[model samples]
Target: MRTARVQDLLGLLHGWYPPDQAEEWDNVGLQVGEATAAVEKLMIALDPSAAAVAAASAAGARLLVTHHPLLFKPLRRLTPDDPVGGVIWTAVRDGVAIAAAHTNLDVAADGLNRWLAARLDLLEAVPLQPAVGHLVKLAVFVPTAHAESVADALFAGGAGQIGAYDQCSFRVAGTGTFRPGPGTAPFIGEAGRREQVEEVRLETIVPQRRLPRVLEKMLKAHPYEEVAYDLVPLANELPGVGLGRIGRLAEPVALAAFAARVKAALGCSSLRLVGVPERTVAKVAVCGGSGAGLIHEARRRGAEVLVTGDVKYHEARLAEDLGIALLDAGHFATERLAVEELAERFRAGAAERGWRLDVVVFEGDRDPFVVY
Candidate 1:
């Protein structure tokens, strides 16, 4: 049986939800274990609690993928007596690697918020606040014969990727002139002589997060001893990624009815609502976890009701004053739906890559809260 390495899974996860999309404070990506370690079985969960670790170990899983990261803060010690330290110790002892998707998964196009909207059958859903990132236009001068090779290297290093497209670039034939200074070893001409060579100007778009690796690959692949390149910053928003989402319902429904629909879809025992039951709502906005901060934005985007978790008393009051309905559907309940979805995605990706790996959803995990 062919075993998939930790790096392979990371590639698939990051390809769909790049870590750059995560908030500044989030700790994402591989938290424990080596990327080169072989993984034969993987488990997906919402949190990295002690029970989750034990369940993964019991199932003989080599990797534990979670929505929440274990190491949120810097650790001063690694003693098993501590809470976070105990989870770390258990994972290491059981030979289980740990990874997290976190805020990046929340912001992805196929992220938790999107799933929530789809579950409620929202119409014309769009991001409440679109994600903005630095984009750079990389222009590189390459020898005519080596343009294709250099472009290939840039693409491999994570450049030229736009929505649903890869290896996208533009090239123009041009001329290049260079004088190899003393002590310089030229790839095409004598060290002390002036050289005029036919070259191509290759231009491509790259995300700022990928600039370093792309430049490294470009330099390594260019034929010239002194590679010339220009990087210009662009002011543009990244497409298909953001925090929260707003959309309309196919038909208007009472606020109480919408709350009931949310409870049923999310498998919640009960949820808090902050509006009149008879109030009618057609436009809805949703954020997966702890999204009270987006209430004002939702209202600004014309959402009559906002469905999210972790709404404070004051925030709920504010929602009522703003004349928008608010639903607090427990943080765990709102986000846990992604566990099975993530497992299925990984399973399909593994099969496509011919990796003999078992993907399992950790049903042993549960909400920490209990209603008396």
Candidate 2:
């Protein structure tokens, strides 16, 4: 069995969501264990609970990649004598390495935000806010015969994606000048004589974190001992990273019916609703948890109903004043939908690597709310 390294998993995750995309206050990445630790089996879940940790140990998983963190607030002690302090303590004693992808995963292009938006049937959905400072332009020169191979490698390494279509790159024909010195081996030129050869200038855009990999792929695939490449900083903004989502529905439904639809979609027993039933809901906005803070932004963007969690009394009153409907789906209920998407992602990723990954949805882990 081929064992995966913690750093390998981290590298793949960075492609999905670069660490800089995370909120500054958030703590992400490898929480415990060595980066080079051998990981054959893995357990993926929403939260790193005490029971989940125990389950991971029983399943013989050396690595656990969870969405919610086991330790959000800092811990000053690790002792089994205390009730709650021992949960983390036990995980450490069991030798399981834990990693978390929180807000960074939330704001990624194909990440939690987009996944949730699509689940709600939001057509024409795009990023609520484009990612800043994440796109870079790369220019390289390759021989005419090797241009396609080099370009393909960059695309495979997560470059050349502008909007749609893979392996997308712009090329221009040019003559390249280079000379090999004595004792130097050149793929295209003889030693000691400057030679002009037909070449193509290739250009592509890559995510900032993936620049290194893209460059490496280009170098390795290009048929030259000395590759010529330039990294140009670009002002072109990336449109696929953001916080909340706004989109149009299939058709407008009355606010009450729309709320019920959401409840059925999320399998929630109860939720707090604001605004009159007759209000039509077409334009919609949503953020998974504690999204009441974005109410004004949602209204400003012409959203008739803002579907989110954690609505306070004052927030509800303000929503009513704005004539915008507010659907207070429970925090856990809204966030729980993300788990299935996360599982699918890991399944596909692991399969591609020829590794077996099981995303176990902890049976019986549900919202702790009951109506008496």
- For model 2, residues 192-300, the per-residue Cα lDDT tens digits are 9999999999998887878889888888898888888888877675667788888999999898998898899888888888998888889988888778988888888
- Decoy 1 TM-score against native: 0.92
CA RMSD (A), model 2: 4.3
Give lDDT: candidate 2, residue 254.
90
Checking candidate 1 for backbone clashes, the offending pairs are: none
Top candidate when judged by TM-score against the true structure: 1
Q: Which stretches of candidate 2 lie over 4 Å from their true place?
A: 1-12, 36-41, 71-85, 140-158, 172-202, 215-230, 235-239, 368-372
RMSD of each: 2.2, 4.3
Per-model C-alpha lDDT, please? 0.91, 0.80
- Each prediction's TM-score versus the true structure: 0.92, 0.78
lDDT of 1 at 240: 72
